[model samples]
Target: MDHLSTTHSCMEHLKSQNAKKSGIKKSGGKERPESSFVAFRAFLSSCDLFYIKHTCNFISRRVQKHSHLVHCHLDRTIGNNAWSDLFPRARSHYLIFEASDHRHIISTLDSKKKKSVRLFRYNRTLCDNLEITQLVKEIWNTSSACSVADKITRCRQAISTFSNEFYVNIRKLVQLKDSLDAALSASLPDDDSSLG
Candidate 1:
């Protein structure tokens, strides 16, 4: 399974686990917590195709013993499966607590295998344009075998390319307007444009 389904499996397990602990009921009848999180241990049976590592990203103030407070692991790391496959020697280290009560979890990965990602912002106005609409539709139907993720990536690229061109034009227009205003001001003797 991919990251989404893997994460969904883990989260669904946690949600049900929490509900049971908090005395909350849900649909789908009663599910045993152990059976719900089969993905975690089941990976081992699948010839170690995936792995689940329990790591603490932060601390939740719960479970008080005597005069001291004990915190249980609230956040779990399910993606360690890929990490082991990429860098077997690397391990997660919990750094010292900083401004927040949560400690940072640092793990090393093969940087060469990772691709540089830039943030993409979606604007509602971009969707209103005919070009963008047509672009999205064309990309969505371009390949019958394209997965949903692939289609989304293509649409984003198209929208980003179109928006970038518009942005450049806007910048050029602003610069041209500024230059004209500067030239007009210089042509006049002073702040007065009486044309005497």
Candidate 2:
């Protein structure tokens, strides 16, 4: 059993135990409120191959006649009909079982993992990469303070150029719309009685 299954088993047992306490009687007539998780774990130890499940329960309970929060680690392993169970969510961290000649390992995040994204051609009207790169190189490689001022001036000029280009395109679009409207009107049947 994996950590997930162990967690699920623990949750099921806990639910059953809770139901028993709340007068929501189970099918079995047994009135034991204590869980059988520990015993289940012990039975798992003597097996050659075993499965474990880890669970994290956040339920509060009354222990010793007082309300207290309890976290139970349920480790249940099944091997050769013998079992050993634990309750902690089987974190990826594992202990070295030198006697069994098995070393436990956990997964770790890679700091050097590279992130990449595809640049799509969403706006074909935008300047191409070569033009932008050349502009950047010219601005960066310029030595004189006057060249910096020139770079700013060029940027402003580019902005104005783009602004004029946008208006020109808008004007063309408006003209086309007007032409289309004129064509549509021309194609309509002229009737003096329809003028309401």
Candidate 3:
């Protein structure tokens, strides 16, 4: 939700300043009408019911072309402790004043690290295979290092290499089996005379 009262007042003040420069009588040095302030205060009070003012960091500076006023208010729940979960590290920034009358206000929320998804793939052909069992036994018995961590690392590397090689071999065997089956079907007669 954007609160534009500060911007509206700034614009009114600018208009009044321009009028004074042109020898026009200012409205008793009052830029905004009394009724407008009263209405704005009422609106703020109503907003206070649902949100608490988190910060009063004004982005625009008074030295610039615009007035330094709290045009944007960062609000959060009064009793909600889960603000971090919603916004993480929330911050406000004032971008460079460009061609616009007012400087752009930027609000940012720091993103949390996302959890990585774990994938588990199983190959039934590799299970209970004598070659796979022998490969594991050979790698596990190999004296690559004296330390347990080093040995475990070596074993993991060996198993990964073996799995890659096994997968390639399995794919080749499957292709061969499919080609042999196709050739056998093609050689068989379409008619039932061969069955007799």
lDDT of each: 0.48, 0.36, 0.40
Poorly placed runs, candidate 1 (over 4 Å): 1-117, 167-170, 173-196
Among these predicted structures, which one has the highest lDDT? 1
Candidate 1 local Cα displacement, residue 163, angstroms? 1.8
* Model 3, runs deviating above 4 Å: 1-30, 49-85, 111-196
RMSD of 2: 23.9
Across 136-193, the per-residue lDDT of candidate 3 in tens digits comes to 6776678644577766666566656778775686777666655543332332223333
Better of 1 and 3 by TM-score: 1
Residue pair clashes in candidate 3: none
lDDT: the better of candidates 1 and 3: 1
Q: Rank the candidates by lDDT, best first.
A: 1, 3, 2
Sort the predicted structures by TM-score, highest score first. Answer: 1, 3, 2
What are the candidates' C-alpha RMSDs? 21.4, 23.9, 25.1
Between candidates 2 and 3, name the one with more favorable TM-score.
3
Q: Which ten residues in a row have the lowest lDDT in candidate 2?
A: 56-65
Candidate 1, 10-45: lDDT as tens digits: 221221133222212222223346555465455433
- Per residue, candidate 2 scores C-alpha lDDT tens digits across 1-196 of 3444334433223222322223221222334444544453343342233433322221212112233222212222222212223333332233322222122233222223358754332244445646555654565566346676787666555545555665487777666655543332332323342221
List residue ranges in candidate 2 displaced over 4 A. 1-128, 139-143, 147-150, 159-172, 184-196
